[model samples]
Structure formats: C-alpha cells, structure tokens
Target: MQWIENGDLSFLDNRGMNGFLEYEKAVREIIAKVRVNGDKALLSYTKQFDHVDLETLHADSEHIATAYRDLPGTFIEVIKEAAGNIRSFHEKQKPDSWDVTHADGSRLGQRVTPLDAVGVYVPGGTAAYPSSVLMGAIPALVAGVKRIVLVSPPQKNGEISDGVLAAANEIGIKEIYQVGGAQAIAALAYGTETIKPVDKIVGPGNIYVTAAKKEVFGTVAIDSLAGPSEIVILADDSANPDWLAADLLSQAEHDPLSMAILVTTSKSLGKAVESHIQKQVRSLPRAEIAKKSLDDFGKIILVEDYDDGIKTVNKLAPEHLEIVVTNPEQILPEVRHAGAIFIGAYSSEPVGDYFAGPNHIIPTNRTARYSSPLSVESFVKRSSIIQYSFEAMQNNGRKIAEFARYEGLEAHARAIEKRIQE
Candidate 1:
C-alpha cells in the first residue's frame, strides 16, 4: 500500500481514482443497438457475452418454482429474515400523500404514488448475491410499486442462480429474465418483443452495466451509476490494527478496482496495520485481486492530528466510511460526505451490506458527495395536487393573471381570467 503524509499528499487527486472508461464505450454501443433493434439485439448480445443459447429470455413461473425447491431450507430462511429487516427499514421511509384545505375551500397538497414498474439488475458472473436481490427489491416493494422485474445474466449452462430466483419469489417478483450486462439494461429501458420496458432500473453491475445505466438515464430512471465497492477507515492509535486491516481487506477483495484506505494520526498504527494486511491477505482466495487493489488504489495517510485525518476522508468521499477511532461519535459530525458510516469497532461494512437493514447499493468513485443510498424515495414519485374553488380563484385571479402576463404568457393569464369570469 502507498504511504503518504496528510499535508503533503491529497489522496483524492490520484489519477487512478476514476472509473474505467474503455468498457463504458462498449456498453453505450450495445445500448444503442438494443434500443433500435430490440429483441434481436438482445439475443445477439446475450449469446456473445453470457455464452448462453436461449429459446426464450424470460424466466417462467415453473422455472422460478423449481428454483425455490432447489434452494436449501437454511438459505431460504436466511433470505426471509434479511428481507424482513430490509422491508422494515424501508417501510419507515415510505412517504404519504396529504392534502390541506384552506378557509376559501381550496385544497392543495402532494400525492405520493408508487412507480408503475421497476427493473432490477443483478450481476451473475462470479457468484449469485441473494442478499442483493433482497436489498434492491425490498425498497420498491415497500414503496408499493406495482410491477417488479428482475434481470440477471445466466450461468454458462444457461440457468439462473437458484438463490436469485428464490429471493425474487420471496419478494413476489414475477417478471424475471435470463439477461445481463448492458443489453439487459437496454431491454429494460426499451421494451423488446417479449420483455416490457420498466419505469426505472436499480442494482450494481460491471462498468458495462454502469455505462448502460448512464446512457439510458434520461429515458428511464436509475438508482445510480454505481462504481466498484470502496471503504475508508478513519482510525487512531487506539484502534485494533488487526480489525482495521481486516476491514480494509474486506473492501479490497470486492474488485480489482475497489479502493480501501486508512486515514490515521498514528505512524506506528499505520505500520502495524500494513504488517497485519500482509499476513492476512495471503490466506484469502481473492488475494491477487485484493493485492492489486491495495497496491494501486489503497493507501495509508499518516496525519499529524485527528482533524487532518477527518478532512482527508471528507475529500475522498469514499463509498463506506468506518470510524474505528477512540470515540467514533466525536468524529461523526466531521464526516460531511459518505454513502454509509459504520461507527465504532463493531459496526463493519458487511453488516450494513447484508443484515443491518440499510441499502448497500451505495454511490462509489466520489459520487457520495452528490448522490445517496437507494431508498423508498427512489421507487416513488411525488405529484403536486391543486384544487381551487371559484371564490378562491376569484380572490387570487388578478395576482395570477399579473404573474402570467409578467412572464409573457398571455394564454396562461387569459385562462385564469376566463375561470375568474365564470
């Protein structure tokens, strides 16, 4: 891992920080093709990327039922438990439609409505993340979205993961497709012959998936253009070096591009953590990927004081911020930007990612400064409600007309005038 002093080096300025660009262009081309050609384009891309020859892209009820039966009882129980927690957390975030009536008998308020349909994309290359299905689908479910469509790449044998299917079934998601990558995003954004387009798309994916979401954002809503997983640990000398090293490695093992950094005021602590990482990473199966991530994007910045360490963390705006300092709450106020904050030594990033109930689909690559974690709000829309009584319109008609005329909208002013005359 790279070592630097807080005042001398700015960690966020590193050139290796940006998301991979080469894969983005490929995804854009795929999106355009799918948008124009629809199902034909989807079939071609599915064959080329997923290497699955499919008679039909959609997963039928029978397929889903079989998946449910195939999954072990213990895993199914775990999914249900996790889904309950996720649903409970998001249920609190549900917004209500409300109206207020004035003395003049005019009513005005906001109407909260669930999105008609939503498409969730789950990555299928390395492994099946049943937890992701629960995390992504529960929010839409809690918000009362009518239709939930799931899209994931098929395995080499042209089958969807049993766990993915089980989770979808548990959440009452009926429409699922054996599709993945940029093409899956395109199919969801623009309907194919078999698959219907959705109002929004949510979940994490590779660069191709991220770029496809970015391209189709205007046409369809998206959760976020999430990048690789990342974590930043804000620690002091009091933190356990072994725990600190393990936390950093957890994120590092996510992807080759995933970043993990430790910002501390203790040089001795930094050295100890580095030593611990060297010992800990060797036994892991993903050591090569973790090693590359740590070698390139990872760093340990030794600061003169705690304030300096906090300042650097804010600038980096990592996806996951873990405060393992003496008093985690003391530095909590200093953290201005972060997707999620894991306070104290016990609160690890994985806890939030899996069982802690908060959405783990966080903003990455410095996007935490602007974007936020996925929630019930992402699955609903707010429409302004306006009802004006004749008396109320008559009272305010002149002001309304004047405002419309000031904007050079004669028709708008006349419309209000005509209503007032009535």
Candidate 2:
C-alpha cells in the first residue's frame, strides 16, 4: 500500500448507498410479493436465492438440539463467555423511567418500554458467524424484548449454520427461522403466516438486505442502513506496524467492498504496515477477498502531525477506529465520531468485535457521524408521560388555545377550550 500525503478524505462523507439503487427495484418487488404471498414468497425466494427447499419456515426444536450437539464444546464455551460480556455491558445501558412533578401539580416524564418483539438477521453463505447472533440478540434480551426472532439463510441442505443455531440456543433464543436476504427482511417487517412481524430489525446483511430494510423502515424500525464494514487507524511512530496491519485486515476480510484506511504522522510506520499487510494477508483463508478489498478501497495517508491526522480521521469517521498513538487517552477526547474506538496497541479491534462487550453491529460507511452501535436502547421505545391537574389545566388551557388559534387551527383551539370549560 503506497501512502499518499494529504489525500482526499471525501469518501467518508458518502455512504456508497447508491450502489444499492440498482437492487431497489428488485428488492421492492420482493417486499411486495412477501407482503401479498406471505410464506409462499418466502419459501420461493429461499429456493431461488439460497437454493434451499424448506418444508418448514422455522427451525424446530430437534434441529436446534442437533445443531447444539454437532457444535464443538469449546465453541460453545466461548460463545457463552462472549454473551455474558455483552449482556453485562448492555445491562448498564438499560434506561429507567421517572416522573417530574411541578409545583402546579403537572407531571411529565418518559416511560421507557421494551419493544414487544425484535428480529435479528445473521448473514450466512459459506461463513458462519455465531458472533453476530450474540451481539445482535443479547442487547434486545437485556432491554426486555419479549419475542426475539433470528433469521439466517439456509445451506444447500436446507439447514441454518450449526454455529449460528448453537449461539442462538446458547442465548435462549428459540424463534429461529431459515430465511434470508430481502425476503427475510420483508417477513420480519410484515407478518407472515408462520413468522410474526417484529417491532424492530437489528443486524447486518448484504446490499439486498440493506435495501429491503431501507424500504420497510417506517413499517417497522431498523437498526441502521449498515454499509460495508470499515476501519480507520490513527497512528504515530509509537504504533506497531504488524499490529496495525493485522487490525486493518480484520475489517478488510469482511467483504470486498470493505475499507481499511490509516492516517498517521509516521511515514516509516505507514510503509512498514503496508509491508506487513501484504505478508499477513497471503496467509488468510479469505486472501482473495482481502486482497481485492485492499486493492479497491484500502488507503494510507501521511499527515504532517497528529493535528492533521486527527482532523482527517474525524472527517472520515470510520466505523472502527484505533488510536495507536503515544497517549491514546489524550487523543481520544478529540475524536467526534466513530462506531467504536480501540485504544493502545493491546486493545485490538477484534477484541471489541467479539468479546469486549460493546455491540459489534456498529454503524458503517461513515454513518458513525450520526448513528450509533446496536444496544439496549435500540431495543426499547420511549413514550412521553404528561398528566396535568384540573387546576393546572385551568391555568394553562387558555394560553394553549391562544397559541393554537395563532396557528389558525380552530379544532385544536376548541379541544383546549373544551378542557378549559370542564
């Protein structure tokens, strides 16, 4: 990877969402078909896209049990540990409800309630991520979501990945379905004969799944329009090139479209990291995908100082940010946006991606500028509470009616007038 000086950082501002526009027409048709045909469309699409013929839309107890039996005990133990960490972290994020009473006996507050149901989508093709299951579902469970449904595409043998099923089982999630892509998103948003609509859908998927979520957003809440995974490292001479290179490859291996960028003050470090990346990627199982990603989207920027590097990193707002500077804490305060920040050489990005308890379902494609990682808050809704005493209403009703009248709405004024009269 050749380093560029003061390179154009404008790519971070664009989400690359336009790439999905071509899929929108087909995705919309799928959504419409699912809405009308329900289970039939889901089954047909499963066969068409995933090449799986499903007699049942959901995994039964026997299948789940078999999955558990088939998975290695060590994998089971690790998932349990990760789930515990995720649950503990999200438990701290659970919000409480409280009311404030005014002297006039007017009360106002917010009632934070868990959504009734939630759907988690786990991507499945050749790769099996039990990790996504834990990261996506544990937060909803922490938030007290009653019904947690998990959906993943089936293999050619009409079976969800055993690792995925094992993770879901480990989390005590029973509502597992063998459907995926845009069709799975549609079913999650709109109820089918077999699958009930969920209050929210949270997880990562392919472009078609992302487009489907964008389409059904208002019909049901979605976590975010997650784009390809990405990471940016802000480093100095103190940073280790080998570690930085490994961390960059982590995100690059996710997809060919994923981005791995480095902004640093050390030119030598940049060259060394690029050399390490080339050496390390050759050994990865997904070497082809990682190499393609690096060729297409990978970048290295040489900045004059930490100030310039920090400015560029904030502007890019990469999903996963690593601060491998001399004093990461000092540099951390300046970071305005990023899905998650890893500090120091020891705190590798994969630690948070798997076990450090923060949700790995983070905002990608510069969405870190506004969006946040999935958490308990994503699984709950807040309703405003307002109760005014008769005396308080009598004192304020006329004022409200006057304001409504100024806006030229007679009915709005009359409603306040009626309350005042009473």
Q: What C-alpha lDDT do the candidate models reach, one value each?
A: 0.88, 0.91
TM-score of each: 0.94, 0.97
Off by over 4 Å in 2: 13-15, 419-422
Residue 272 in candidate 1 has what lDDT?
99
* Tens-digit lDDT track of model 2 for 85-120: 999999999999999999999999999999999999
> Model 1, 1-422: lDDT tens per residue?
99987365555555332554777778778888987898888878889987888888887678789989988899888888888888999999999999999999899999999999999998896688878898889999999998998999988878788889999999888888989999999899999898899999999998888888888988999998787788999889889999999999999998888889899988999999999999999999999999999998888988888788888888888899999988888889889999999999899889998888999998887888898999999999999999999889999999999999999999999999998865
* Global fold similarity of model 1 (TM-score): 0.94
Candidate 2 residue pairs that clash: none
Model 2 TM-score (2 dp): 0.97
